[model samples]
Target: MYALVDCNNFYASCERLFRPDLQGRPIVVLSNNDGCVVARSAEAKRLGIKMAVPLFQVQEQIDRENIAVFSSNYALYGDISARVMTVLEQQAPAIEVYSIDEAFLDLNGLETNFPLVEYGLQLKQRVYQYTGIHVSVGIAPTKTLAKLANHAAKQYPATRGVVDLSDPLRQRRLLGLLPVQEVWGVGRRLSRRLNQQGVSSALALADCDAAWIRSHYSVTLERTVRELNGQPCMALEECPPPRQQILCSRSFARRITEYRDMRSAIAQYCSRAAEKLRQQGGLARVVTVFIRTNPHSQLETFYSHSASRMLSIPSADSRLLSATAHALLQSIWKPGFRYMKAGIMLSDLYPSGSFQPTLFDAPESPAAMRLMQAVDNINRSGRGQVRFASEMLSSGWQMQRNRLSPAYTTRWDQLPVVRA
Candidate 1:
């Protein structure tokens, strides 16, 4: 058996963790710069505050309903998520971290001794008692069906936050009730096509011939069909696959109009992206930079553009990536438009030691490697004290996290104090 564990309203729960006063109240967590609604509590959802709606549009509702709002405090959320995962890591034999707030755990042999439902409840309660965050557990024979079971656990309160699809009869009954779009790997477009073909329910799609699915749709869809039919097509991936591409992007706290400000933002993003490449021991042959005005804003003139360049040799050096990214920015940036967001993408990556060196390319030097290591260690221990001179010095174009909570777990100064 495979089990999927998912946090309930993760971001909102993170916000509520420190502020127990806001419990059972309408609370929301905003995107970068407090722009749009990224997370909402059950109370906030009852008020009909739709996801991705701009903060300005919901001001009246917020005021009338006395809703509490918070900016995205990623530092706090990440620390909390790590703690939750640590608890699961201690309990499960093998696990795959699917996302920031979700994971898949292996439960094949353990179920032979105890009931699966009891194990799910134990996992759920242990997580809550340890991290103070509620989670739902779903168990099934396959990862895809486990995902479906998790959906059922969250959707229906009658399940009491745990669902087991190990039984074939329950699988057929539940899949019949769920729409085709709700099935794992069936996106909007594919679901629409399936609906048109009279496969409007998960059971209908599961009943389709495997060969016909492979011929008409894809091998991936055929696997999904098999999974829904109680066949284990997907296995528990204990480790994440290596990323082919790495992207770092964020909306600015304020609009930037000057070339120097845009230069700083691009360099910071590239430097961050390069650090990631080095962490993975990978080198990128291509670097791309993009900038754009806020589409939600009603500007006199709106514009968005991007530029990419292939390097002569694959490299993960921060200085080299930052220089190339700044040059790309100069080529695409327009003077008059106020740019609200920017990003850097590194692709065409190869393992650090596997790439062949070109005749004219500079070989990797020990001095350079040592310097990069020192920089990474210093920055990891102490935040951003050692960086390229080209990177931003002041708070010029950082994200606006005005209502951010303190990093209670990670930062020493921000740690909560107990008073007698």
Candidate 2:
């Protein structure tokens, strides 16, 4: 058996963790730059505020309903997620972290004779007790079914936030009720195609022959079909594979017209991407920088361009990456375009110390590696404490987080105070 544990309204829950006054109130967490609604509390969902709706579209409703609004506080949310994952790590024999707000726990030996539902309930209670965040638990014979069980647990209040679909009959019954889109791997486009083909429900898709599904759709979809039939096609990955490329990009709060601002943004992005590459013990051989104007703006001309430079040797040193990124930005940047977004991509990656150097190639310096390690250690202790000089301290292109909450758990000064 496998169990999927998912945090309920994760971003909103994190916001309410330190603010008890916000409990039972409608809350919505905005995306980067406070552009649109990314997460909504259950209360907010009940008010018919759709996901991804622009803030301006619901401004009147927000004011009239007195809804609590917040900009994304990733630091607090990441810290809380770590706490929740820590609790699961201690309890489960083996685990797969699916996302920031979800994980899959292996229960093969643990649930031999013990009641799965009871075990799930215990997990749910422990997570809430330790982290003060509510989670729904779904237990099943396969990961896909476990995901479906979790969906049912969240959609129905009577499940008490725990559902077990280990029984084949129960799995079929629930599958019949759920739309094909609700299946783990089936996305909107696939679901639409399935609906057109009369495979509108999970049960219908599962009933189709796996070979036919593979021939009609893909091998991946076939695996999903097999999983829905209680056959586990995918195994839990304790350690996910390393990324082949590291991309650091963001949409700006406003259009950037000056070359210096664009250079600052790209430099910061390169520093971030290089940090990630080093964290994974990898070095990048190619650096790419891209800048683009807003595609939706009617007044501004749409412009987008990107350029890549091959490094002399694969390196994870942020200084080298930032310098290359800046040169790439200079090569592609247009003077008059009001650039709205820029990013850095590090590709052609190889494991650190694994690349063979040719006679003509200069090897990466050990001193440079040590310096980067020191910088990473300091930044990890406290972000932005040891940024490079090229990265701007303050810039107009920075994301607008006017409604951001304090870092309740990660920062010493931002911790909540209890008043009697």
Instruction: Evaluate all candidate structures by whole-model CA lDDT and list the values in order.
Output: 0.90, 0.93
Give per-model TM-scores.
0.94, 0.98
- The residue-level lDDT of candidate 1 at 234 comes to 83
* Residue lDDT tens for model 2, 281-353: 9999999999999999898789999999998799999988888888888799889888888898999999988
Off by over 4 Å in 1: 294-304, 382-384
Kindly list the per-residue Cα lDDT of model 1 for residues 167-229, writing each as its tens digit. 999999999999999998899999999989999999999999999999999999999999998
Colliding residue pairs in candidate 1: none
Candidate 1 lowest-lDDT run of ten: 381-390
Task: Mark the regions of model 2 whose C-alpha exceeds 4 Å error after superposition.
Answer: none
| Residue 181 in candidate 1, Cα distance off native in Å | 1.4
